[model samples]
Target: MMKFKFFLLQALLSSSLACAGVMGDKPETETPNRLFFAGLGGSYNSVKLDQYFNPLIGTTNIYNGGTLVAFGTANGPAVPFHTTQTTFAPEAQLGYLQSFSNQDWLWGIKLAYNYLSITMTDSDLVSPQLGTLTAVTGAGTGFTGRATISSIQTRIEHEFDLMGIIQHSFKNIHAYLGLGPTTFGTRTNIYNVTGFADIDGTHVDVSGTPVNFASTKWVWGGVVELGMTYFFNPTWFLDINYRYALSPHNKTNYTSAFAGTLANGYTKSGTLFGTTNQYITVQGLTFTINKVFDFV
Candidate 1:
């Protein structure tokens, strides 16, 4: 009976030792769900501006050297002009992350905002007909007049994206690819002036009134990303990603109103119509610190 009791004690001790060794050799597994994240980054954005105006024609009578000269209806270009500008913009995003049962595949949706601005100026002689008339004083001498134009535009983009993501993990480092659909709410304001007469400081007011216009539009787009994450622990990580996004053409209509009397005492009051169709593409490298929590 004594020998049997001693053998039972030895077996129990050997089994406990084996269990400890097995537990020590195995690695700890992470929970399948990561709940929320907030990120900040910089985006390189390109805004394309396509502006076209309808033909503006009018007449004014100016007295030069005590004689009245009549300037008849004149025409401007009907074709639109296009310009592009790039800006380094700051962007912020907030969203929740959802994981699949497989854990290797996940999905997320986020709201992001970016602010951008662009300004361009174009100066040309008022229609050649008008320029030639302005050049001739009542004396028919070579008194030249010229027209100048300047435009300032500001725009903001609010975006939302639904993403499909795949991730591969090696210890604490994880790499991921994300593909998604992006939607944008864009708002823009434009201020412009054409026909400033600065020919030798004579300050002729032949130009149209200063124009203030605003428009808002919605656009559909797509975005893709490749990223890597380094985990500081189970709940904190640093992530860096390269992202690209593009949208189709979207149209905006601008209506401008100007009121002022011309140098010839003619009330230059009227409305001019302009239209723009714009396409935008953006690419950037982003760095973020992500905090993940378990779903309650």
Candidate 2:
């Protein structure tokens, strides 16, 4: 996906350069007022390292009250959920515009909806994994163990962006830029997680139960955009846009189950879980046919 986005960006640049060469030094186009525009485009998005993140379980303190080994916090190698995802997203936009000054500087705001989805599986193995648990007075002090982790974590991002727009025109062409805050109506699912611990120890379990890892409410981010439109007439145009958005997730939430057996045949089962975050950034290129209704 990285290679693909890079190539597509190169192509867009080439096309823009070619257009510039052909349209060389043409007189600037007339400015219009009271305009409404709508557009639809397709984009490709790929994600890399998170700005802020936590593994599924991050506690590793192995001693409880200075006596017992807290097995859950004994994690060594954390789960690798940093897998990359490539998404071909579809987006739609609506905006209203007018000339902001005699200089033909146009100012407006745009609202857009984008579908950015991701899904992946990750695993980790922690041997001699040990943690902090309440000491059962008579359970004996030598609590040591190993654990393995497996899970399928999914992220589906539905984004709505409201950006302020500014644009200037060249003969038969308009170049524009937009900036704004973005909101994510995202959903995450964590399923099929499993773990194994020491024979004489209890393992932490969260995968046995399916849970929603991310919520659909209140994930905020930001975006910057640059685009060009080639006017075929007064009301119709073909546009190509490049957008970059940064989404920083605050935290993750989920419920987990803990169940394991001791070498002495006693059964142990209870609770343990933690929060995490996967902040993602994406760059996209899109092409759309747009229509403008002008009131000049």
**TM-score of every model versus the real structure:** 0.57, 0.70
Query: lDDT of all predictions, in order shown?
Result: 0.58, 0.62
What's the lDDT for candidate 1? 0.58
Off by over 4 Å in 1: 1-31, 41-89, 115-148, 157-171, 181-189, 192-208, 216-220, 257-270
lDDT of 2 by residue, 221-243 (tens): 89999988887776877878888
- Locate the minimum summed-lDDT window of 10 residues in model 1: 122-131
lDDT of the structure predicted as candidate 2: 0.62
Off by over 4 Å in 2: 1-31, 49-77, 123-128, 132-147, 199-218, 257-267
Supply candidate 2's per-residue lDDT for 125.
31
TM-score of 2: 0.70
Q: Identify the candidate with maximal TM-score.
A: 2
lDDT string, candidate 1, 69-145, tens digits: 53422334334556677777677767666666766655665555555544433233132223333423443222233
- Itemize residue pairs with steric clashes in candidate 2: 60-73, 70-131, 70-132, 70-133, 71-131, 74-130
